[model samples]
Target: MKENEVNAKIKAAQINNALGFFILSFGIIILFAMIFTETFIEHMTDMVAGLLLMTIGGGMMWKAKINIHKLKLNKTNDNK
Candidate 1:
C-alpha cells in the first residue's frame, strides 16, 4: 500500500477507537441514570439501551484493534 493510504488508515482506526470509547462512555452514563428512575420499565429500558450501546462500542473497538494490528503487520512486511 502507498504511504498516504497507510497513514489514512491509521487515522481512521484512531478515530474509530475514539468513537468507540465515546459510545461506551455514553452507555455507562445511561446505565448510571437508571439509579434515579422510579419505574421498573424505565430501569429495564435503560439497561437494554445501555447494554446495546456498550456491545456496539466494544465491537467497534475490537475491529479497530484488528485493523491497527493488520496495518502494522503490513508495514513490517513492506519493509522486509
Candidate 2:
C-alpha cells in the first residue's frame, strides 16, 4: 500500500480506539450507577444497556486491533 493509504488506515484505527474507549467508559459508569438505583427494574435495564454498550465497544476495539495487525503485516511485507 501507498504511504498515504497506510497513514489513513492508522488514523482510522486511532479513531476507532478512541471511540471504543469512551463507549466502554460510559458503560462502566452506567453499571456503577446501577448499584445506587432503588428498583429492580431500573437495575435490570441499566445492566442490559451497559452490557450492550460494552460489547459493542469491545468489538470496535477488537476491529481496530485487527486493522493494526494487518497494517503491520503489510509494512513488513513491503520491507521484505
Q: Candidate 2 residues 1-80, lDDT tens each?
A: 79789979988998998899889888989988899999999999999999988998888988998998889789789878
The per-residue C-alpha lDDT of model 2 at residue 27 equals: 90
- Clashes in model 1: which pairs? none
TM-score per candidate, chains pooled: 0.94, 0.91
lDDT of each: 0.92, 0.89
Question: Which residue pairs collide, candidate 2?
Answer: none
Clashes of each: 0, 0
Which predicted model would earn the best lDDT? 1
Local error of candidate 2 at 57, Å?
0.8
lDDT of 2 at 16: 99
The list of candidate 1 runs beyond 4 A from truth reads: none
